[model samples]
Target: MEYDFTLKYQLAADDCDLDQIVERLAEAGCDDATIGVGQPGRVALVFAREGATALQALLSALEDVKQAVPSARLVEAAPDFVGLTDVADVAGVSRQNMRKLMLSHAAEFPIPVHEGNPSVWHLSDVLTWLNTRGGYDIKPDVLEIARSAKQVNLAKEARELEPRINQQLEYLLA
Candidate 1:
């Protein structure tokens, strides 16, 4: 299976030589990716990689980038964070319809990761909710990739959390 995803990284000052970094990435098994460096000190790679599973594809891409640019810090893994329009596009529904569904099922709807302006959600959460609701045309591959991307992003963010915070939230949230 081929999983498509994007990985954005913040490059250390020393690793800003775009040409050299591209060469290194190509050499490091990322020849399959399309590299973008429009922003200073940032690099984004869109990949279509073959793997046994979406998780395998994402992890392998992360490892390849790590080898290519050790100083690069992951900023985000994409197809994970999104807005209603994004969710609607993937679910084959109109943005208004998605909003309606959310408003109607406010209590049962999955909570957004960020609540304000145009709220954002983990794509997988919305997809799963729609899946259970039925009548939504959710592609298996898309749902799988979105789920894998969510897991990867959460794990990356988890590395920064204090262990004590988990202990603190465990009881409160549960």
Candidate 2:
């Protein structure tokens, strides 16, 4: 018997800030994962499998991603198996980097769906690995610069509206 499964996800604000979702999927026993942008704040994942126990593996994978990235909204779909290269694209990392990370710590990487052939990394595994490593912090000056920029933009917007407000007042008087 063959078991095929798919899972999609919509990420929340906090979830967007990290790659934990991908890492978690890998831990759950899924193989061949792909992620894509849905709406502005949504992320979709498609996982595939082929085995008698594929369905059970898929469910385990989904639970893992959900637990790790609580803000993620999941949507299951029909499996459309993708390659490791595809998973790399979704993780925003190069294939080389993915391999390097996995090779560095084999225990941390996801299990391959097939015994032999083009090896594929599960989406959940990638997310779980990412969750283990937190994001980089911004420099203090960079944050200050961002704050200044925001203030400038707000001031410019207010200035632009002032003329319109005056014009409306004049029209009302007339």
Model 1: lDDT of residue 121: 99
Q: How many steric overlaps are in each model, in order? A: 0, 15
User: In candidate 2, which residue ranges exceed 4 Å CA deviation?
Assistant: 18-20, 23-31, 79-174
Off by over 4 Å in 1: 170-174
TM-score of 1: 0.95
RMSD of each: 1.2, 21.7
Alpha carbon lDDT of each predicted model:
0.94, 0.52
Ten contiguous residues with the weakest lDDT in model 2: 136-145
TM-score of each: 0.95, 0.34
Give per-residue CA lDDT, model 1, range 5-64, as digits (tens). Answer: 999999998896899999999999999999999999999999999989888999999999
Mind giving the per-residue lDDT tens digits that candidate 2 earns over 1-174?
233344556677766643555566555543356655556666665544443344444555556666666667653333223356755665577879767876787886767644356774434444545556645232333223223323333344456577879689669879
